[model samples]
Target: MSITRLSDLADKAACPRLVVKVGSSLLVGPEGVRRSWLGELVEELAAARARGQDVIVVSSGAIALGAARLGLEKGGRGSLADAQAAAAVGQIALSSLWAEFFGTQGYPAAQLLLTLEDLEDRRRYLNATATLTRLLDAGAVPVINENDSVATQEIRFGDNDRLAARVAQAARASAVLLLSDVDGLYDRDPRDPAARLLPLVEGVTPEIHAMASGTSGSGMGSGGMTSKLQAAQIAELAGISLAIINGTYATPIARALATGTGTLFLPRRKAAARKAWLGGRLRLKGTLRVDPGAEAALTRGSSLLAKGIVGVEGSFERGDPVAIAGAEGRIVAHGLAEYDSRECARIMGHHTSAHADLLGYAPRSAVVHRDQLVLK
Candidate 1:
């Protein structure tokens, strides 16, 4: 569906669940937090909530706020420790501000700080999903952010854009609004006189991704057009639509939702809940290599048994997402592992009966239950 104007969005049915990601540059200023802009945004979100829509906000600005408080320069500077310290101090301020803003609008808000582990581990992922779902069900808005205070470069989401996409997938949101400095995608840099804005994106193809260039001009934000495109791709695969919109104006969230004044990236197709979860995984804890028989069984909707397993690669705990590969070393499916890597190695080629004697405890029979597996 091509959405070139805000009227296009108004003609369509209202989105049931929405995820809005606000950039640090939009929320933070050199003087301090932009209260007026934030209040407007909160009012817009509250209106959506009043209309019976679930709204979640993935906000950036902790580090920016912390930097401002410490009188440090923004952008890529200082050590990991310094960044962590800033995040620790800034997150408190950011959360408090959100609470106050949402409170004034008569909307309850909760803060969620997540790390990579929260999404990769099946147990934690489910827990987070349940919490978010409960909050939405209770008419509360969830204000989410990366747990930058504890996350390192290796474990962090790197940008709120991708984290918002992940959050959308987890929450099963119908749409995502990326509120940033840029209004929408362009054939070329929007700063150039010849550049043309792309109002609608059917998919994030290689050619489309190629159009993105440069970082977010704001020294406070980490993501640029490239990251937003990456986020759109992720959202598309999860059966969610994403839009990049200019958030400098008042009521940006309401405007984007009502008028579609942004580059709307449509989902490729609808995905089942299990398929969405499988496709949206950003990290795989390990890989389980199986024989031809096991691969065939998996294709036929059978559980991954230890008897047909050939190898276990990498270290992972129980309930962690793992890649299931076939004899040809191609990933055939993704599933939550019932056993750890070490246990799987020991039980490989063994029957379910032997699991008790080998592991000293009788756990589940299958390495990965059929219900938990999603084929690639």
Candidate 2:
């Protein structure tokens, strides 16, 4: 909450705070961990570091990096266990490889492994933000990768594209550079003469989605134009700028950062959208009619207390999302109503401590807890 309004960030930083995600297709070539690619990336990243830019790399070459180094044929040629084993084995070498390359450039790199669960939970989310900030503060480029050796399909990020957006949000980055083999988002397959590259996107409109054709490039990755659009939407929602450009091009990222040459995705209309999406998590299962005083308190960003409930409507279970409304009929706040609708109805007009003996057992003190409530 103390972070800068992402929509208000300065245009492309003199020392840009960036979360750069590179897919496997661009990381490794027909041989493996293409020295040519890694060589170019290291020099550019090091230069950025020297200029005082903070960079966090959400890299995807791990699985492929692991597979190729382990001498496994294409990614599918191995079993799940085989893949995990390969990743476990390859990650060591992968980190060492990056560590040495970065060392050679007189910069230090830190390997930060993450899973989807790390970002989804609120407590873990805060902890992760703190850790990444501290790392960047200490001047270490965080080389983030999904903990693939243990992540199952159900708990997986599915692609680094989405992970990169989340990372950008966490880092409060000015932009997320999605470096792939393609130059930018195109109207059709760019390989075809009919396809056209879109230079700018205002918001993620349907037309923008239309231009997002399917996957193109070489890799064991499933991220296509569809996933890139998904990442773009995520970045937009967080009010972070994003660029999808070809990593294969020489000095691709440096050039984009210098002139905003790649496709520029404008930031979202933040305050309103943030109020709608990040502010509303639970579906309303019932309603609570509050007195004028409680309504005023809620408007000032206070939690809904037990004494506020004049009446509870409809059947809603504990932890179910509910709406708080005033006597004049307007929503005050959206919250997780603590007690079930039946129990809430029983204690509607009573204070929290007053309900214990009447029901033979004490229920939750507050009608709705603060942590469960999201202010409008």
Candidate 3:
């Protein structure tokens, strides 16, 4: 829907859920974590919670804080190993800051550290989504950050902006608020005297991409206007609205809501049926060859039954995404596996009722549930 006012994000029926991304510059100052600014932001988030909105925070500051604590220069952590070490040290500090500030407002904050694998792997993605749902259901704010300590340079997002968009997709959030150094997207270089801020962006077109600047000059933060643009594109594909605003001021979120002060990027359409990630975003781990009956059943929107499955290919774990092949090895659909490949091999021609006797445990009814399937 259209959201001309930032206040619309606070409405439960209208927006329901939101992901707020706080940049390292905004979170950790020269001294340490900006407690005063964070406290004010927490107060605003608490108000949103009172309004029945589920709030998730994607914060960047671990490396910045760690560098300061380790007596390293702002950009002194030159190696990947050094940066990862700093992240290990700073994660504890960053998490505590979030907990302390949110705790004061009577809200419990839950920390989630994710690497690229967590989002790229189907099983981990499901697990992360479940945990986020449970935390929000319990009225806790989920504070998320990339797991830099264990993540290699090849696997790191290196920016919280894109992570926030992925979190929005995972949590099925309606909106994302990116608090950065600049107020919003500008028509031209923000440093230019004639530049003008674009308040509402209908879509991230080529023109929009042209307006984006490079990464931040500030050594403390990695993301800049370009990363924010990438985040907007991700959110748009997930049918989540995203806004970027300068959070240098106190109570930035509250102020944005009150004055509609930001660049709001609207989604082109709603997310595809079920999760957009489940459609074609994931890498399939295995293949399931089903008989004619199963293929027909699936075509009619029925779950795949074990008795109708004839073969299993490759290795995969429960909750992993797999391809369902029909006649002539043509893939009919893709879905999350209810059972692992080895288990599927044993029960391929057996009925669900015999699963307990064969596997020595209770089993899920279907081999692949229709709810988790996307027809190809």
Clashes of each: 1, 0, 0
Q: On residues 58-134, what C-alpha lDDT tens digit does candidate 2 reach at each position?
A: 88767777777677866732676767767787678778878888888987889988887787554676678899999
User: Judged by lDDT, which candidate is best?
Assistant: 3
**Model 3 bad stretches (over 4 Å):** 1-4, 273-275, 278-376
Tell me the TM-score of each prediction against the true structure.
Answer: 0.76, 0.71, 0.74
Cα lDDT of model 3 by residue, 312-332, tens digit: 999999988899999679777
Better of 1 and 2 by lDDT: 1
- CA deviation > 4 Å runs, candidate 1: 1-13, 75-77, 254-260, 285-376
> Lowest-scoring 10 consecutive residues by lDDT in candidate 3?
273-282
Q: Which residue runs does candidate 2 get wrong by more than 4 Å?
A: 1-15, 76-79, 214-216, 257-261, 271-376
Winner on lDDT between 2 and 3 is: 3
Tell me the tens digit of each residue's lDDT in model 1 across 164-228.
Answer: 99899889887888888878999988889999988888888869978997587886777899999
Clashing pairs in 3: none
Query: How large is the C-alpha RMSD of every model relative to the true structure?
Result: 5.3, 7.7, 8.3
Clash number for model 3? 0
